[model samples]
Target chain A: MKSLKIFLLAGILVASCTNDPVEEQDSWPVDFDALVALNCRAIELRKARFATADSLRLDMDSIKASMNQSDFEKYQNDFETRKNALLSESNALADTIRLRMKGVMSDLGPDRKRVFNDSLQATLKREGCE
Target chain B: MKRILTLAIAALIISGCAKDDEPTVQETPTKSAAAKTYDADFMIDYFSLQCDIVRNTNGFLPTIAARGYGYLGVTAYESVVHGIPNGQSLAGQIQGMSAGSLPLPSADLKYDWALVSNKAMADMMRYMFGVNLNPDDAILIDNMEANTKAQLSAGVDADVIARSEQFGADLADAIYQVSKTDGGDESYLNPWQTPWEVPEADYCWIPTDLQLQPLSPDWMNNRSFIANIAEDTQIGAHIPYSSDPQSEFYAAAMEVYNQVNNNTPEQVTITEYWADDPFQTCTPTGHTFNILKQLLAESGATLEKTAVAFGMMGVAENDAFISCWKSKYDYMLIRPVSYIQEHIDPDFTTVIGTPPFPAFISGHSAEIGAGIKVMIDLFADAQGNYTFTDISQQQYGFTPRNFDNFYDLANECALSRFYGGIHFTMDNDKGLELGIAVGDAVVNELTWPKNIQ
Candidate 1:
């Protein structure tokens, strides 16, 4: 009975310390280094996507220049299908990165959030996203 | 015997004078002021920094960016005009800037024009974007100023350089003072004013996206750099908005939808290249300036000519946005995306993201129109057939695009808006027309000296 009473008191103390359940659930220590690494990863993903799209575009240009109109049309339709799929994939990746960014942003206090965003911008610019 | 001795002495004297003339040096021709040029590398760096700031600044609409560029360009021009012979001040010619307003540079003092430009830009940028800068930007501004000052101080007399720097600062101060009263200050860097409440009337713009915040709705309320831009320019009228599939308005929406649906790879490339969209990317205005910078560098232009070109571009673009915005808000016409989703296709999306604003005259078309016209006026007579590769987006890993002429580039920029499915055909056409007129006015109406021309 004495041990049970001690357990109850400890639970009450824990609840009192974290009275705001939503804040307790949402707040976490932001690893700024990890966040920056994530930003770089996002930029790399974008660069890859852009490069792939550019290659596909160049191939289309060459094919159009060399092929007959009928053949070009068939190829063009196929290219469009692939392009749409690529766009969807790229968008999904961007969305995932964006959500991670939001998590980082939300975890920070206002001052730290501003600092993180500024650092992130500088990093992205250096990474050629500027 | 005495006569012979005197004649012999005279002969010796004459011989001595002739020998002296043989070793005399000819004077080197003095270079004309037009030939005089200061270091322009800093201005290029300064503008690139401006692009960086524009990229980072939150909610910076294109019109606002244009306004900021106008000040930066004009300040750079006016600060260094002392070094350019026969270069006239734009103060009295441009509206609201008076002959009495400018502080004249001291006559016959050897001045470092680049130093002058550096000081003016440093001060102007610090003040112009002062309210909006984050801590990182504030530090950048300080570092940029310090580095410029350090560079200018090398191998230069302290007193003279100090005087020259002060002269530039004074000029910028005078301009900044005038700017404060121009209604720009109240709206400076404020890009997200509560969108003007749409009236309960026919053809009003309805919100399309979930966020539903229209951009820069009160932009027209900000005074134009050129007063006449607001009063004189005409966008005429757009086809009245309608839901009927056969109506001109509906037809325009259909065209946007179809083009987006049937977008080719070439069309996609054009759209993406000219989009010059958000993030730390140089906004469209900056992109035009970047191209101009490249052209100027390659043309081997003197600093005076470069300054004049940038100054004219600034005025033209600044006024173009003013005229474009006036038309946009005057109509409050709905975006094609909004209309298409409601009336044409619920499942359709644009090839590129739609900017948050009313659709009428496209800003990109207007800016390009102004840019090409001003460029032709300045350089086309010489470089009308010149071709150059645009490496502006090299950092983004895109291959450089080439243009045969400024016109070709401008036309491509205009067409890109249509391909992106953001503008109606008429918007691009009419915006270009308006921009051309504005550009012409800036060139013809301004009082550049005949000597410089």
Candidate 2:
């Protein structure tokens, strides 16, 4: 009975390790379409975030134009605060996208890696991300 | 009940293992019959690659690079024009090209427009820049062509694929024939040949550091993509050349001198960003092309829109340089560096090295001006703002910079030339004005198709 159990465990391991070469070449190991859908969502979010940051920058410019010398230091401090806040938000969003990118990349085999990367960049560029 | 539950869990595990053992044949995603099928992404990727090629290519003068890009741009448009139902040929509307000069796609035929564009670009880039390319770069172009062809040919009918590829190659050859006569003349084979002679004049440009001949002096006389022979292509008059301390030219030189002296960190960064330097860097036109690529991608541009964006900017920038160069040589303006060292500051060095050509109107300013004008025409808000990040130089290790709008970007590019102490304020300002005119002509004068949604 113990020998039977060991034989079953070894059989399972071999089965799990085997990957069909044709399918591996033809299709991604993970859900590629799902990843693309997730990426599109991230891009939409990023676009809005960037637009908001730009508007904030424009507002600062307006305020700076109108400010007198006495208010210059205070204006600079406020600018730094707002800028830092925007940077923090930008970093968090980028981190999320990076994680998604890594997940997608993990499934791509060596041969398909360049093609997948090229496609990903095209998608990102198309979606307005740099 | 507990024994039953244990058995059930074991059964589920066995089923999961069985599932993993199964050979699943996943199908590629389906598309509607009416949905556009061409890959616009490939066109964008290859053009960006071409920019890198042009940047890395040795002795590719600005004018020569512009001309190469112009041909590549039109080839892309012509390759896919048949696919866009509303698209019209840019021939005849452009100078030297007539209607029917290039072949049109057959109405009855089906096509993979992406393949058409891909083949056209690969062929032309190889033909135009191949001899000058190093072995590694050559491999890159070849790999892109082979990989794209393989990907696109899957599940396509053998005959249809053959016909489509043949059509792309034929169109590229026809366009290439026209390209040859535009004063380029096997320039790839002899990049530094048919050398330009610097004419003798009071202000005729002399060689600056690391420069030999005046680069592309004959480019002013090259066939323009726009502007007929009789067209008025001159800029508003430059401040007349003078060495007197009170003269306008002297004061202009002083502005450059003073700016270099008081050069802030911000000014230096802006200069480097727009400098688009490094022998491997695409000049200002490449920078603008990169922006266009990003904008089109952002808009989810169709193949037709992709072609037109490249086409318009290509025509605008190519002609702008031709017009700017004409004025550069015609004025024979001396460099600010030479003038400043002689009259104002002998020890004064420009923050960036001066280019070989005479500078009355800055090429960067003119190209950026033309580029921005077309972009504003296409995508600007009511406030005339079309914000985008420029990472065109990122591959060369420069960080991406953001702009508030097209005009703001153009203004910064103009300022960069000034901050570099290469051009006086007049060259940048008036060059901008001239570029706007050229860009306007490209948009208004040509009878091309409106962009696809």
Candidate 3:
């Protein structure tokens, strides 16, 4: 058994000398769709925000009054729920991207620092949500 | 080619000069049908014939035009859908189709006066009459309608003309029923807010079943809501001047008002007389158009043909209105006012503040947008152009510019809402989409007679 194992090792060693190792293709399943949905929700939120902002000019007091009322507060809560749903969805996408990129970090090594910063900045901006 | 180029450049230069620089003729052609007849103006909100009836110094013509104008201006868009078979209005479809999307299908919601222009008037006439006016009928209806001398000499008093027109309208109402005979459920042409006993479905913008729905006590207040007997209702009346024989224009208005009220379900009370604040500006007092269906008699469109055409347009417009209203109501989000009233918006300072409504879609934009589509179709086969010139006064027909036909009128009329401040850029965009879509569908779907074909 020892001799047989040594023979296998010797073959691997000889092959290693002559052959260049093939790069491992890391294929991780990505939920890109979650990201798309998050972005769509974000865009819709942004439009609603702008529309609300536009409403302030006519009767600021009334607008505030209406928004402050319970029904509007409920609506705001619903909106926030949707916003958080998008954030979670985006986070799931970021996590998937992270896992895939980690497996192929050697190939993406240079791309890693640049793309990671860009992605971190983007996610942070989204999370911060001003 | 060189001469044409030089002329084009010269014409451009000349046109660049203010319209005021043009020569003014002092002749007031109010009495002369040859001079005062409906010139080829497409911009006129009321038919030139109706205008002529009002312009008559006989004191009754203006009254006739005023009555007709009110009917035309306030109700004609709705009626056009009801007047015709399967004549759906663009308003309803747009309201429903574009609902919930502001950036995509948003439109303005308010009264769109452009719905009353010449194309609309002519379209109403064609749909009511069935037969397109041969040049002679167009000319005759055009000539005899306005001038005081012509109307007076035509043997009928204001009473007779009005009565005949009323009868024509009644007939139109009955004939419009034909649209529903084969249309399945969609054939019932509802021109205005029909208070659904159980609300509505499909393209219903306002869900009668919703708990948060606004109460439309005033039917006209909401584009899709019907003012019921519980609300201040406006039931129509038939004062056939021909039958009454002694009916005057002012008297007709009063009588019509009375008749409408009397017919009201015994559940509500009404004002004893119409009151005047006296302080209201003269701007609110201008005349409106009422299509004298009897005027089609002079135009040689047979009574049946006129009724059919009128009924078709009326039915279509109403259908459009209902369609639009439901679409909007179903997507009850907000109006310009709602968006305008919001306090948190930063861009509010950049704009003339919006109304108390959602920001995305415009109600007026959808209604006028779609209404104009059905209107244009009714006249697609007819002749005559549209012209409107707000001269020293806001007189539409005062301009001499020529129009090829009704399509040109619809194009320019659609833009007028922008100036009126009721619709936004995006609202107009979507409204136009729905209007054209619905109008096309109704026009194509409705069965026109083989003779007209």
Candidate 2 local lDDT, B1-453, one digit each (tens) = 999999999999988886322321211112211114465777877777777677557656677787777788888777766665555676666665766677655545666677777788889887778468767778888899888889878887787677778878888888888877888755655443446566776565666653556667667777887756214656767998888899888898899999988999889768867876533346777778877886776567767678877888878878888888888877778888878877787778777778878888899988888888888877886455855555444333234466667788889999998998989999999988888888878878775566454
TM-score of each: 0.71, 0.71, 0.30
- TM-score-sorted candidate list, best first: 1, 2, 3
Lowest summed lDDT over 10 consecutive residues: which window, candidate 3 chain B? B272-281
The CAPRI-style docking tier of model 2 reads incorrect
Question: What TM-score, to 2 decimals, does candidate 2 have?
Answer: 0.71
| Alpha-carbon deviation at B27 in model 1, angstroms | 25
- For B122-154, candidate 3 gives per-residue lDDT tens digits of 433333322323454456444433442233335
Q: Once model 3 is optimally superposed onto the true structure by TM-score, how far is the C-alpha of residue B40 displaced, in angstroms?
A: 15
DockQ for every prediction shown: 0.01, 0.01, 0.02
List lDDT for all candidates, in order. Answer: 0.70, 0.70, 0.32
Model no. 3, DockQ: 0.02
Runs in model 1 deviating more than 4 A are: A1-130, B1-35, B186-189, B200-202, B382-384, B449-453
Flag the better candidate by TM-score, 1 or 3.
1
